[model samples]
Structure formats: C-alpha cells, structure tokens
Target chain A: MTLSPTERSTIRRGAARARTDRADLHAILDAGLVCHLGVQIDGSPRVLPTAYGRDGDTLYAHGSTGARSLREAAEEPAVCVAVTLVDGIVYARSLFHHSVNYRSAVIHARARAVTDPDETWRALQVITDHLAPGSWEHARHPNRKELAATAVIAVDLGEASVKVRDGGAVDEPEDVEAATAWAGVLPLRWSWGEPEPAPDLPPGAEVPRHVRGRGVR
Target chain B: MTLSPTERSTIRRGAARARTDRADLHAILDAGLVCHLGVQIDGSPRVLPTAYGRDGDTLYAHGSTGARSLREAAEEPAVCVAVTLVDGIVYARSLFHHSVNYRSAVIHARARAVTDPDETWRALQVITDHLAPGSWEHARHPNRKELAATAVIAVDLGEASVKVRDGGAVDEPEDVEAATAWAGVLPLRWSWGEPEPAPDLPPGAEVPRHVRGRGVR
Candidate 1:
C-alpha cells in the first residue's frame, strides 16, 4: 500500500525526489538503526534520537515512564518521527545543484500511550527484536516491575511521507558541459563490526550465532 | 566556555550520561554527517533530516528560499537540531537492559535567516566543507541567482545538550549470573566507499586527492 500524502506531507520544492511507496518508507526505516523523535516542550520544539520498532503499520517508541518529554508527547500535540539513511554526498558541477543522496521517512501523528499490559509486552518485544534480534529469544524477558516503569508510545503509519534523492546531482546546461570539475557521489556505507563481549563474561562463554550473523539489520 | 543548560536542556532521566563540556558537544556535532532538524508547523511537530555546518558555536542549515519550513523557523518559535551517531547495539542478559551505545547532541534555539551576501557565502562554504571537504575550493562558486534562491538558517549552540551512552549493557546481578545469554555489544561503523564519478565525466578525468583521502570525515 502506498502512503497517502496529506496537504502537509507534500514535498514543496523537490517534488521529484518525494516517494509515495510504503515499502520504500519501511525499507528506509528498517535499514536505519536510530530515529530522531520530535516532541513539543512548552511552546518550543525539542528533537532527540531514540530507538524505534515497527510492527505492520504501527511504530513504537518507549522510554522510562518518568521521562518528561515522552509524557508531553503522549498528552499534547502530535510528535514527529524521522528515519534517514544517507546514501552519498552528491557533487554537482554547479554549487547550487550539489545535494545529498538520501532516503528519509517522516511521520506526523499523535502516538497513543500504550497502557494495556499485553500490548506493552508486545511492543517491548517488537522493539527488542528490532534493535537486537537474537536477544529476545536468548535473553531473559522483562518482568512485572520492569514493565511498570516503561512507557510505550505507538504511532500509526497512516500519516507519513518518504523522500529520496538518489544517483548523480543535476547540473545546469552550460556548467555541465563546460566545467571539468570532478562531480559524482561519495557513497556512505554502514557495516557491523565484530561483537565485543562484556568484560564480566565468564570463561568459556561463546559468541552466539545471533551476534555472529548480525541479525535484523 | 561550557554550555549553559536551561531547564529544558537539562537531562532529567539519564543524568550520568549527560555531559556539560561544550567541547564534547562540538566533537559529537562535528563527527556526524546529518542532523534531524525539528520545527513546529501549525501546532504539530515536524522533524526532517538535513545537512548542517558548524562554525565556531554557530550551526547553519540551508534550504531553498521557497521552502515553507525554513521560512517558519526563521520567523516563529525555535528549532531543534539533533545529531546522533549509533556506536553500537548493546545486548544484555536480560531484555529490559538492552540498549544502544550512541553519542547525540541536541540544540534548541531560534534560527536567524541569513540574507547578507557575505554571510551567506561564508555559510555555504562552511556547509560545503562540512559535507564534502575541499569541494568549495574545487567547484565553481555560487553565482548571484544561486545565492538569492538559497535560504540559510543560523542557530546558536548555547542551549544544547549532549548525551552519550557507551560500553556494555548493564544487566541485573542475578540475571547476569543465572542466564546463559550471550551478552556483548555489536559495534556499528560508518565508512566511505570508492567515489563514483559522474556519468557525463570526460574519459581521462582524475579523482581529486580530497575524494581519494576521504577529506573532512
């Protein structure tokens, strides 16, 4: 299903770079490990990085119940969650044409404060599995008290927009032909390195296949 | 000088992870490639990933002059600039303890619209140097019309907060001893791949040393 762009979600200047494919949005979100969440504090805006997980069409962000920002986000104005994967820095023959090649998904919605125990448990599991894949099955799950202190905010994906800029920069007619400038893309890549074991691990501890495979990334 | 945290900039939840050193904030900001800029639109929050440049304690974000968000930010309530680097994914013996090792800097302030020609040129140079080093010197500089079409927003770094989380996950003593879970941190690394030249490039054009050396990273 494609995302329905609202009047607010439309790309004003660079309309060609905007995407409507829901799958593309999900791909960008899944490829990214962190998201910047925006919550209004008082009359101003505050943006912070946090971990997020998606289950079907719903996105989840959790923090300690005592978090002031999270509490404000759940109660008042709608929050914004943005996940961006920068592919490369585009160099054009002309300075005005230079841009970054990126895939970005932006969602605007008021996240529901998850209160039901079952939903909260499910959301945590989804978040855990999203951030660390094998650990949910391998590690101990959250108990009663742990759940009590955590707050989960669930935002529907209905109101969202995806913008992507790929390939080489577009330069003007004269500059494109006249200049001998080195113009292209410097691709950026994200890779997972070897897992470093905790300092307190006992002797003969094994690096599980989950860590070895770099699952869920 | 260190950052003077206001009531909003104070880290209420993870005080241990918050750093007041202004140098730390600059370092975190310098190392990041993209920042999520948040601006409130019509009472709802909107967050989008944008490229930025830092000169001294001032950060600059540029966009099309016709951009609505940029105009609003220059006129109304303050904007938030957040840069986050995911260092690693921490897996603990217990699921609740799972977390990510990251360094993030968030700045909250009003952004001024730069209209002066000299300041706009300087701001563009700072931004270009930050994204692709040596390009400002290599490529043709912006002409009159190009500068007129671009809008630059300058934000101060006074009311900023830096939160860093590193090392292994902290699991409960009982869970660590009893559970046989593989606990460790899966490190994430970002690197530049070989530069891909523009499709319209001449046959024998050379890749500049700046690109070869991965400058400004």
Candidate 2:
C-alpha cells in the first residue's frame, strides 16, 4: 500500500526524495533503531529520541507513564515520529551541494495510548525484539510492576512518508567542470564492537547468539 | 556558562540523567552529525532530521527557504533541536529495566534566519566543518547564487538541556538476583569505511587527509 499523503504528510521540499511505497516506509523504519517523537507540551514543541517498533501498519512507542510528552500524546496525539538512517556524507565540488545520504521515515498520526494489557504486552515484546532480536525470549519479561510504569502509544502508518537521499553530491555544471577539489561520498557504517559484560555478572557467562548476530547490521 | 534551563528546557522526566554544564551540551552536540528539528506546522507537530553545527552557544541549521518548518522557525523560532548519540544497548535482567545508553541534547529557542551574508558564510562554514572537517578549505566555497538558495537558522544554546544515560542496567533487586539471563551491554560504534569516489571523479584523485582523519571518531 502506498502511503496516502495528507496536507500534513506531503513532502513540500526536495520532492525528488519523497517515496510513496509503504514497503519503503517499513524498510526504513525497520532498519532504524531509534526515532524522534515530536509532540507539543503547553504550546511548546518537544522532540525526544526513543526506541520504536513496527507491527504491520502500526508504529509502537513506549515510555514512562510519567513522561509529559507521552501524557500529551495520549490526550492529543497530532504527533510526528521520524526515523532517519544516515548512510553517508556527500562531499561536493562546491560546498553548496554537500549533503548527507539518508533514508528517513516520517509518520503523522494521532497516537492513541495502548490501553489493552495484552496488546501492551505484545507491543513491548515487539519493541524489545526490534532492539535486540532475540531478547524477548532470552531475557526476563516485564512483570506487573514494570507494566504499570510504562505507557505504550500506537500510531497507524496510514499517513506516513519516506524520504531517501543517496548517491554522490550534485554540484552545478560549471563547478563540476571547473573545480579541482575532490568530490565523493564518505559512507557511514554502523558497526558493533566487542560486547562488554556487566561487571556484576557472575564469571563464565557467554554472549548469546542473538546478541552476537545483531552486529552485522 | 551553564545553560539556563527555563520551564520549557527543564528535564521533568528522568531528571537523574539531566546535565547542567554548558560544555557538556556543546560536547554532545558536536559529537553528532544530525539534529532533529521539531516545530509545529499548521498546529500539527513535525520533526525533520537535518544536519546542524555548533558555534559556542549558538547552533546553526540550514535548509531551503521553501521548507515549511524552516519558514515557521523563521517566523517564530520556538523550535526544539535534538541531537542524540546512542552508545550501546543495555540488556537488563528484566524487560522493565531495558534501556539504551545514550547522550542527547535538546535545545529550545527561537531560531532566526540568518540574513546577513557575512554571518551566513560563517554559519555555513561552521556547518560544513562540523559535517566534513576539512571540506570547507579543501572544497570549493559556495558562490553567491548557491548562498541565495539556502536558509540558515541560528538558535542560542541558552535554553538547552543535556541528558545522558550510561553504565549498566538498573534492574529491580529480585530480578537482578533471581534472573539467570545474560545481562550486559551491546556497544554500538560508528565506523567509516573506504571512501567511495564519485563515478564522475577522474582516476587517481586521492582521498584527502581530512577525510581519512575523520574516520577515527
């Protein structure tokens, strides 16, 4: 399904980067580990970086119930959540054309607080597994006390848009021909280093396969 | 000088992670390559991931004048710019305590469009140097036409807050002791791979030293 771009979700600038395919939206969101949740608090804008997960067309975001933005989203969720993957830094012949190659998914939705306990449980599991692939089964699940402190908000992917900027820089014709400076892309890679175990952990514990495998991406 | 956290800038939630030093805010902002610019567009929230630069107590963001959010910011700069660096994933004994170790700086200010040509040049330079350390000197500088197409917004760092979460998981007493699950952190690192030259670049155009040095970070 192609995302239906409303007046709010429409890409006004750099229309070339805007994508319509819903699959592209999901792919960009899935590849990202964090999202910036945008909401208004007392007439002021606030953007907080948080972990998110996608379950089909719904995006799930969880935070402490005590969070002001979460509470505001629950009350009135005309919110924007953006996930961006910075792929590379493009160096152009002229500084004017220097840009970053990135894939960003922005969703405009009325995020409703997940009220059903079962759904909350499932949403938390999805969020956990999204961050750490096998952690939901490997680690201890959230108990009642933890559940009470958490608030999960869900936003439909109906009004979402994906924008991607790739390839090398686009310098002006004259600058490209006249300039002697180097022009290329410095691609950014997200890598994982050796895992550091908790100091309190008992001796002889091993890093699980799921934890080790997540490094490739 | 320390950041003056107004009512809007104060970190109400997770106050334990809130930082007071202005230098800390600078360090966090400097270490990041992109900032999530948040604003209310037609009374609905919107957050766009864009590159930003820090110059002492002021942050600079540039975009096309045609962007709706940039225009809104120009009119009333009550904007929230967020920069986050995710250091690692904290695996806890219980799902309740799972979190990401990160450093995030959120600035709340009225971002005014830089109309002064001299200031715009400097601001662009700061931005270019922040993204690509030596590009400003090595690459061709922007001509007048290119400068006219860009809109640079400057936000004072006076009303910003830094929040950092580090170290191990904070599990409940029982969960920490009773749980036999693997508990630690999976550290995330940003690594730069071999620089891929643009297809149009002539052969044997060597990668500059500045580009090579940036990889260490």
Candidate 3:
C-alpha cells in the first residue's frame, strides 16, 4: 500500500487520502478500461468519458474517424483526464462524516495529437486490445477510411496525482463511546458476469475462453 | 428513462445513458451526494473528492474547518466540481473499443465563498445529511472554531455537461456474425451493506431503520 513519492501528489491531503502507486493506478485503469476527459473549451468545461489505454506513462485515446470534439482536444493540448473506481462507502456514526473509499488517478497535462497513419493504426490496436485481450486479432481491422476519420491523442504520465481511500470508516473517539448511532463501511464491488453472445450470430460462434474468464476484485 | 433536454448534455455523447430522468442535473445533485473537485495547484493538477449538496442550480461543498485547500477554493469564484457514477462495463469483441456505461455531471464555474456563519452551518448540515440521511440530527453539530475552520464553496451549475453510455455494446453488423468473441454487459452496482457499530459503544445502540435500509438506485 506504500508508494514512492513521485507517484504521489504534492498536496498533503490530496496525497494522503488518495495514493496512486503504479500498481494501484494500473489496476484501477485496467479494471474498467474507460476514462473521462475533462476539457475546458472556451472557459466552459465538459467531461467526456471514453475508452482509453495506458502505454508506459502515456495515456492514449482515439475517437471516431470524424469526431470533431476529440480532434479539437488533440489540438487544444491542455486537458484533464480522470479515472475512478469506487471500492465502497464509508458509513460513520455521524452523518456529516460519511464518505466513499475510492481509488482514482487524475492527469493534468497537455496532450499531443498523433497524426501518422501508421502510428494511429497501431495505437488503435493497442487501445482496443487493452480493453479486450486478444481482440485486435479476432475482429476485422479498420480500413483506410476508418483511419482517416479517427483522431488519437496522447497525454503524458507526468503531472499526475493518485488518491485512494480504503478500509473502514474513521470516527471520532467520543462518537465511539456515545450510544447514538452505527459506524462502519458498506463495500462496493464490480464483477464480470457470464458472457452473452450476440443473438444473431452464426450458430457455431461460441464464446472464447479468455472472453469468459473475467477477473474481478 | 427519458429526461428533459436540460438534464442531458448539449454535446449529445456526454449525456447520461441510464435513468435519464434521475440523470437530470438537479436530480443527480439531489441524490445521495458528494463531489470531487479538480484544481491545478503548485504546478500539478489534483482532484479531491469531498462532501457536497445542492440548492436550486448551485452546488455547495464543505470541507474540514482546518482545510487550507477548501479555504483556497472558497476564495476563488469558480472551481471544477464533478460527480460521477459508473453503471456498467461494455465488453465488446474488440479490445480497442471497450467502453463503460456511466452517469456523470461536471460543473466548471466560479464559486463564491460563503462567509456568513449561518450559511456555513446550513451548508454543513446539507453535506452531512447528503452523506447519511437522518444522521445529522443525531450527531454533534460543529461549534465555533470547527465552523471557522470549515470552508464552503458554492459553484453555479451553469457551464456544465453530463455524458453516459448504456446497455450492451453496439457491434458492427459483420462483426456480430464473426466476432465469435462474446458480447454483453457486466452491471456495476453501488450498495450499502449492514452497518457496523463502533467497538466501544455502551453495547445497546442498534442501527436506525433508515440507516439500515437499502439504498435506492
């Protein structure tokens, strides 16, 4: 649970409450395979949750071949990318003190647009496979038209902070002795269920073992 | 599940995908509440998740009286407040294309620091009750210094947006027949479990019915 300082935020509260070790950040990111991009467009902010993948210290995101917003994000450079996983709710004796124990990572940095067709195509594959292992090989690869319509943006791993809250609720010592109310944590969990194949598939298309063998914490 | 246009994001893809009605900007704010504030501090960006509540279209956040960051947030006119809920994961055949179904609201506006003692106390109650319903009445209210140390920041709900993705993955027609990879949704849920009492209690305090009741979706 202890992480080196570089993976930590400078603000004491921001760092203490939310710890982002490499393992912790990667686990949270890999579990859901999606992220929300906070963009301040013309001083107006917008949060766009989309599919994303981390390669080393760079996070990669791709948009539909013709998506204008993402294209603009690539052009803008400065943006905030946030990803979170809610582990549970902290229920305390006092209502004013309830909280959620969650794991999250936020990157505040400029992104560079990946314009090379080859790099974009490979990045797309890396992103796709990150979401589903063994997927790029199973599905048809995008053609030239698809490549032309897409935009890829990469945000560096620097200037990032990770925060996490886990375990039971922390209550005031006096509140512990007072017979007034209950205090504890209500755990939250995410699980992968049995795979359901597309209804219109050819009869012989059985689900792959890797696809069905999901990992849940 | 359809919500008024005001409840949805103007950018289309950013709107809530589930219970659009409950997904309305105000409704999401009114529901069991807390928000994460993202700010750029000391050359790094940090997102701090904390307790919050709403009055009309304005969102108020209250932090520990000794919290310097909250004080700084209050001193400023606008800050970024984001509330997000993950509903499920969209496991598609292609790895690069995996997505999540979620409901989220983001507000980027100047927050006027509320300095009136009475307003600060009221904001505390709203934040407290928002975390655990009916507990504020039973818990000890903040006294003078605690009140002084606390900071309350109210951000206007304008210049905001909500985005979401729901249901099963939308696969390509041809991929549906050949994907052989399974396709479906693994629903994500947030639930409150039975409460655990503080260990040193006088041994007779039972959890209140409302505190023990199941959370609403």
**Could you tally the backbone clashes for each prediction?**
0, 2, 20
- Across A90-125, the per-residue lDDT of candidate 2 in tens digits comes to 988888888999999999989899999999998998
Q: Estimate each model's TM-score.
A: 0.98, 0.97, 0.80
Q: lDDT tens digits, residues A102-216, model 3?
A: 7777777787899887777778877876766566776556666657766899887666667778777577777676746666666654566556565665677677665667455
lDDT of 3 by residue, B1-217 (tens): 3433443234544223433343476766665345667654343334565778776666788776566557666654446777777666666654434566666766667777888877777777777666666667766666565576667887777656655566787777666767556676666555565566545556676766656674755
Calculate the i-RMS of every candidate, to one decimal place: 1.1, 1.2, 3.5
Name the better of 1 and 2 by TM-score. 1
Best-to-worst order by TM-score is 1, 2, 3
**Over 4 Å off, model 2:** none
Better of 2 and 3 by TM-score: 2
Runs in model 1 deviating more than 4 A are: A215-217, B215-217
Task: Please list the Cα RMSD from the true structure of every candidate, rounded to 1 decimal place.
Answer: 1.2, 1.3, 4.2
Which consecutive 10 residues in model 3 chain A have the weakest lDDT in total? A1-10
Which lDDT value does model 2 have at B210? 81
Local distance difference test values of all predictions, in order: 0.87, 0.87, 0.65
- Tens-place lDDT digits, model 2, residues B1-217: 7778788778888899999998899889889999999988888888989988988888999998777788787776488999999999998887778899999999888878899999999999999989999999988887777788899999988888899999988877776677588788999998887888877777778888887668543
Between the candidate structures 1 and 3, which one is better when assessed by TM-score? 1
